[model samples]
Target: MIDQLFLNNFKAFRSASIRLAPVTLLTGLNSSGKSTVLQSLALLRQSYDSGILMSIDGDTDSYGGFLLDGDLVELGTGQDLLHEDFASNPPGADPRISIAFTTTDKQQYGWTAQYVPEQDVLPLNLAIGPSDWRDAALFSRRFQYLQADRITPATTYPRSHHQAIGRGFLGARGEHAVNFLRHHAQDVVPEGHPLRHPEAGGHTLLDQVVAWMQELCPGVNLEASEIPGIDSVRLSFGFGGTAGLDSTRRRRPTNVGFGLTYALPIVVACLTAGPGSLILLENPEAHLHPRGQSRMASLIAAAASAGAQLIVETHSDHVLDGTRLAVKQGRLAAGDTAVHFFRGNGAGVEIITPTVAEDGSLSEWPEGFFDESENTLDQLLG
Candidate 1:
């Protein structure tokens, strides 16, 4: 697991070191540098996956450097990524962007990319870390990054053998989720795993997914199947909750309410998390009601307890409260969870971390940190 993330002259940060916990919750206002934290980590992973993040041979330009455009992230160019107000370098030295991280085992890995405004591939003049760093969670196959702009409810989803099967990846936008689910439905969840839904019908992955989805919409079960002679998969739903209703009738994703389909990737991602996993989530509470959002937080907590390191960027107060409830209930330790609120401070972004106590109470709640409901209530009473 990554212990800390350091960003120097990257995007909105001139120089910032963000602490990461087993389950880190990053809450903030719009453009307050919350996404930048997640993007930087994605950028590093994408660069390394493209064979451009580390130096194997003496030559650093061709074989290794930061690949700005790739499968993970598409940061346009050095100019777009570099911080605008970077501090001056030493005499005759050019400006550069650097990203580095220290793991829990005290292993430090860093990369420095030259600043060429027009070029996307920032050639590294200096790189540090051993090749064995691939063993780290960041480079591991268990890592999942679900961006905010995910796939909407549709008739059918794409089926990719290499990505969904070979790589075991639910696409960045979770576009391959249905296909991945169709393939892994029969796989049994590890015994005594936190992912096992007690109310689920069986120990299989699909059962747990349906059990969890039922939290959002009671008695809703889903199925994923391959389209005959096509590179697409179909996701259909069945309902058993309504009295006197026919549960056999199937419902397409377009018919099964947007919240469940929109939140499918998150459910699958959390259920798939295991030891040494690194899951990056963006607004996992996007399109759900208050209770459903809180239940999603419980699922996230369960994943962390199962030994995955999750860094979540969210805008939901219910998520925050639910995570605190997890801590209070001993599902997650107070020390193992970190909550950071990001806000602009006139000069640059400021990250404020509050303490979580044993009673699901926070040590501090900054003025703008989930205080909108209270503020509005005060106005109504006045």
Candidate 2:
């Protein structure tokens, strides 16, 4: 579980450090830098996974080549990136990215990566041992970051990996969701019988997911199958109606509503992720109905209860309500969950942590924060 995250001069963040919980909910207005936090984590983990930064050997000059072009404009000099710019008085005037997290074994680790504006490079400053890098290596595999605009309905199959059958690895745009489900179906159910194993908790998890999805569109059933020519297994959803039982049985995954396709990856990822893994989700409530959004919150909370750490960036009250519901239902403790509200001020974006009480009440509610209906009503009544 990532216990903390620090950001400097990364995107909208000039300098910020956020303490993480088992389930961290990031909510704020548009352009408040919520996505930036997640993006930085993704880039850092990706670089580590691809050996992009491992080859740097602590040399700032060698790291300059890897900095994004835009980041160079923010950092005037390459060498200045090494020193923390605490004196910068302007908003969004920080020049470093620092993140601190703890592994499952209670090992504390910190990484500070900054962009050299003059030379366009990013150098990594780590606060943990070389062995910790192995766990960090799994960061790329464990952490899954997604954007809202990128999500789409399953209108077509992805052509990149033809051998893909079921859910694919934390799929891009959730295209590999079905493939991932089919491939990992055994993991979901030990005996390979998903329906019959009522005693198995894992089966119950998947069944609840399928049942919840069915509530959205009745008569839809999900089943896994292996095609003879395909190298991977596939998950197909059967629909029933006047279209005929045969037609419903023959429907491909592409025919389902966008919500299912868009949400399937999130559900599968949470269900499949191992204990101690960090799951960073950007806008998990995107394209989902209020009910579906709430359901997503439940799923995410459930994942955290099962041992995975979840960091979600969302604008939906339903999502917020879902987490609170989890707390109320005893699935999550108040201290185990946190709601961080990001507000842009003269000094970049300020993060406000809202404490969740034992009774599911927030300690503070900021202005223009999840009060959409109130704002609308005031305008109309006026």
Query: In model 1, where is the ten-residue run with the lowest total lDDT?
Result: 240-249
Question: What's the C-alpha lDDT at position 48 in model 2?
Answer: 57
Model 2: how far residue 357 lies from native, Å: 0.9
Local distance difference test, candidate 1: 0.88
lDDT of 2 at 361: 89
Q: For candidate 2, what is the total of clashing residue pairs?
A: 12
**lDDT tens per residue, model 2, 113-214:** 554556545666444434445555235456555556544544344432432332135553555555555555555333443122232324543454465455
Q: For model 1, how does the per-residue alpha-carbon lDDT over 218-306 read when each residue is reduced to its tens digit?
A: 88888888899999999988888321123578888887667888899999989988989999999999889999999999999999989
lDDT of 2: 0.62
Q: How far out, in Å, is residue 159 in model 1?
A: 1.0
Reference-based TM-score of each model? 0.96, 0.77
